[model samples]
Target: MCNLYTSLYVAISVSQHISVYSIGLGPTELLLLTLLAIILFAPRKLPELAKALKESADIIRREASGSAEKSSVEDKERALKEVAEKLEASEKQEKKKRRFF
Candidate 1:
């Protein structure tokens, strides 16, 4: 049980550190890490642990991408609104000019 937790912690920490620091580990390092995980944990546990981690990662990725898309849409809407407001102001100015003439 302790070994499982320790290995999982190490895996999560390594993943976070890699992403945060942009550490580039090649295929050999990844293979070694996978083998180390297998050595640390039961073979049967690996699939289940990998599945859980994959699901968690997917959820986080979807959420981040979704929020980014949402913000971009909001920015587009804001820009459109600003353009509309400027057009309306210009129309008012045109009307004022017509009334003056």
Candidate 2:
């Protein structure tokens, strides 16, 4: 039901952000990629290209570590609040059952 969709939505949203700052490439793979970029582009252009890339990476790193952590903390708080509400509701039901019996 609705809860399943909600859970999936939250999970997918979080995971998309999890990879925002990373390509998941290992050191060897990253080395190869850099080598390929060097081969494909001119040496003179490489420094400018690298400077732009570094700036972009710094922005991404800052966003991921700082803003993302804050949002993730809020999401966790929201989820925990939901669970607490559910538990409280269930406890109320149990109390009603006891009173009826």
| lDDT for position 18 in model 1 | 42
Candidate 2 backbone collisions, by pair: none
The candidate scoring highest on lDDT is 1
Pairs of residues at least 3 apart in sequence or in different chains that clash in candidate 1: none
- Write down the lDDT that model 1 would get: 0.72
**Candidate 1 deviant stretches above 4 angstroms:** 1-23
Q: How does each model score on lDDT? A: 0.72, 0.65
After TM-score superposition, the amount by which residue 77's alpha carbon in candidate 1 deviates from its true location, in angstroms, is 1.3
Across 1-101, the per-residue lDDT of candidate 1 in tens digits comes to 67666656556554544443234766567657767877876866765666676677678778989999999999999999999999999999999999999
Any runs in candidate 2 off by more than 4 Å, and if so which? Answer: 1-22, 72-101
Query: lDDT for model 2, on a 0 to 1 scale?
Result: 0.65
Q: How close is candidate 2 to the true structure, as a TM-score?
A: 0.45
TM-score of 1: 0.72
User: What tens-digit string does per-residue lDDT give for candidate 2 at 3-52?
Assistant: 44443343333334344336775555555655666567655555556666
